[model samples]
Target: MTEPYHIDTSSNWRRQAVEDWLFGLDHLSPGMREKVVTAWVSAWASSSHERLEDMPFSPGENPYRLMDHVNDVTRAGLDLGARAAADWKVEFDPEVLVPILILHDVDKPLIYGREGNAGVHAQLFHELPHGVIGGMLLKELGFAHTIVSTVATHATNAPFHGRNLEAHVLHYADLFAADHAFRQMGKTPLYLRHGR
Candidate 1:
């Protein structure tokens, strides 16, 4: 685990940030906490770019790439989940939700070039079982089994065996963000333009 990626436990900012995030997840069981944090950090460590500007995905004209989309979706998921938790009076740890949000798309980078269209990329990556890979990554990082299972099962749709309320929230949030981004990119009709 340490060989492929190094955990910067020395950085106060990173350490503090992680702690704060974990604190939010205090509602979860100890095992869940370990799994979520491990998965979250593993995804971040792998997807982090050298420059912020290098985050977005551009077909050709743009300088960024699809990895940026992954980051954006993750953030959107966190925001949406927080709002939902507040509105529903559900006592959830933002830490738990946040990590799940972040790691939901851990395999996007690996599938980008291989699939040209967004839908195809998603389908192809879905085939690769990113959730399983993410779970393994979480385990490697010392997360608890519960969290690892949660992260791995986040993207799975219902009736097939993988669906949790928290994970579902994160998944919907990602979809919302991606739809918004598609509209922004002029690939779809903007909500306002639809005359709804």
Candidate 2:
């Protein structure tokens, strides 16, 4: 197990919000759960937004927030995992999938900001695509290789694809959630817009 990344979150509201999303996963070990909390805390602490919900899901004229997007992905990923397991007759590990789904966009807060503001962590936001810095952060924090790879490759334009069942499940779940958000915003879904 990796050493814990401890922080004083007694006053941080985001800590509770992060835990609310992460709690009650039967497959997520305590160690893994702490790592997820650490990731969210570390990212938000270094970010510009005062509230997690204040951060938008993507840049530009989108109304959706990062918190909402994360919730959508997590919920979608779990549902997809259950359905896929039933159909394929193979078990998917929530321990793996949940963390990857939760942390896949952990770097977004650093990369984006409230409208009209520059990226809070430009050092990383300007240097790499969406998932690279996030994956590297997880690695530096000693996340397992599978978890890191799944988070890293969950992006649509990532050069290397994740090679695990959890990664595949996360990819589709992410797309489904994104599509739902886009539809709610009255825009064409990426999958339908590009037909890719």
Candidate 3:
């Protein structure tokens, strides 16, 4: 397998982290392991198309660009989730976690618009929450209820009642990836660098 794409590739630390998680998977039952791997492969393959127009881009931006961003965020979340799950000893079905990580941001393209900035992508669209949309998509694609539920609620930040450890990990991982990408592009928010 090719190295997974990440927004921060300056070092190999993330790769090592994922490897460590893979090693821990050996403790899972064979059936469970197979299910997780299958979900991972299916998610990756379904979302792998490089053309943005093929995705559900909004009005102005190239679909390809949007797809690239989605890919970056999704990969970041998956990597972080794996690392966090391993570190926390969270015993989740990898099948659920892996697909949830991959599909958490699937709503971005559908919400894209020319007017607003990135921060409002979720708010601007007003579709079902991205998490909810993700869950629905996963279900449409034949994923189980557990995977759908996890993906749909990953972003519940209000009461925090809707998230599990894996979902929270995915959310934070996405934030980290987005921050890193923006910084690399010289678009890092002022508050992030200087604590405004």
Candidate 4:
């Protein structure tokens, strides 16, 4: 049997810091949670950003922090998923949903740089979309196909929007987070913008 991938978060300040944002996912299995945290910490370790909070939601002068958006998406997903389950009697697994939400933007750290120079490395070494990179990482780390595929297709611009319940919930949750952030910043929401 293959050994589970593990990282000693206690020894590294960076891993602990990243784990803070991932605290509320007890709904996920320990192995899945470890993989999710592992992905985030690994991305941070590979990137130029000194901290998880240093990564931005987008590449430009955007004010949204990547983790903030991720947390927002997760919360919104839970709320929406609950409502859908209660109202429409649809079934979805939180185990699948939560990890995908947490790791959906796992590539942000790698794709972006420090505050002043974000996306510089992206223009060169990281050309893939954040979703694609994240999906690739999760796959390399042995995540389930459902989780990996959902993370891969969760991007708004992804060619194949997934057909599963978790994918649908994640898609709207991500949109909800970004829309709220953009509106709060007094810019037009991405869904409302043209030439996307």
RMSD of each: 7.1, 4.4, 10.8, 4.4
Which digits, one per residue and each the tens of the lDDT, describe model 3 over residues 1-196?
2222112222244333332333234534566544434433333233433333344333333322444444565566567766766898766565556555555655454444334322224232464555665555456556677667766666634234245676676667666655655555556543376633
**Tens-digit lDDT track for model 1 on 1-196?**
2233344324334334444543234545666555555443444455433322333343323333454555566666666767877898775565556566655655443333222222223233445565666666666766545556776776534224345566677767666766666666766533344642
Candidate 2 total steric clashes:
0
My TM-score estimates for the predictions, one after another, are: 0.54, 0.85, 0.52, 0.87
Instruction: State the lDDT of candidate 4 residue by residue for 1-196, as single tens digits.
Output: 1222223244477767766777457777777777778888877776667767688777666667888988898888888889999998988777787888888888777666655743344542345765777777788888889999989888877888789888988888899899998886677998899999
TM-score rank, highest first? 4, 2, 1, 3
Error of 4 at 160 (Å): 1.3
Sort the predicted structures by lDDT, highest score first. 4, 2, 1, 3
- Clashing pairs in model 3? 52-63, 52-64, 131-152
Q: For candidate 4, give the lDDT.
A: 0.76
lDDT of 2 at 134: 80
Residue 17 shift from truth in candidate 1, angstroms: 14
Clashes of each: 6, 0, 3, 0
Q: After superposition, how far is residue 152 of candidate 1 from its true place, in Å?
A: 2.2
The CA lDDT at 106 in model 1 is 51
Distance from true location, Cα of 51 in model 2, Å: 0.5
